[model samples]
Target: MSKDLEIGKKIKTIRKEKRLSQSKVVEKLIQKDINMSRETLSKIENNNRSISAIELKAISEVLNMEIGDFFDEEEPEDLVTFFRKRNFSKESLKEISKFQDMVRILLNHEKIYKGE
Candidate 1:
């Protein structure tokens, strides 16, 4: 799939996961002075229209997600599903917990390195 479509799919998935309707998202965008119509948002979510940087930023804010989340090659939902579908042993669970901690530490270090 195209990158634009991928990003749009991510946006739609996250919006739905957050229990937000397109109209509700548009309402929030208006509160942010974006003036987006629900139709426009639908088009965006369907990959029928391109999104501007400002629109993307406002949408991310309304969705309570970072803009970078939309651009990630791996979907977070996939990882969640993988974990949910697995019946791990105690040792495996412990290893997963340690891996999660390491990932957190690495992310924190990356943020600090970037002066974020």
Candidate 2:
């Protein structure tokens, strides 16, 4: 499949996963100053048209994802999303960040200890 088609499939998958309709996405896009018709979205989903970076950014955010996720496989999880998925509260997430930092420090210490 073409890159554009692959990206369109990814978008469609995310939309379905989130239980969002194309009209709902269009409404959200309006909030981001992206004025696109449902037909335009259909074209995008069909990969009959290309998406601009601005529109992609707006759509990705509306889909609650980073725009880069559309292009990259194995995209790194955003910390906020990681914590939210685990049902972490904001305060708890900040604490988790501390713990994550400690883990990195420990890993670095081990690397030094191993002289690698």
TM-score of each model, paired residue for residue: 0.62, 0.61
lDDT of 2 by residue, 30-69 (tens): 9889999988998898888888888888899999998878
Q: Indicate the TM-score of model 1.
A: 0.62
Residue pair clashes in candidate 2: none
lDDT of 1 at 108: 100
Residues forming the 10-long window of minimal summed lDDT in candidate 1:
75-84
Off by over 4 Å in 1: 73-116
Give the Cα lDDT of each candidate.
0.88, 0.88
- Candidate 1, residue 22: CA error in Å? 0.5
> Which 10 consecutive positions of candidate 2 have the poorest summed lDDT?
72-81
Candidate 1 lDDT by residue in tens digits, 1-116: 78788888899999999999999999999999999999999999999998999999999999999999888666454333456468766676667777777888999999999999
Candidate 2: residue 104 Cα off by (Å):
22
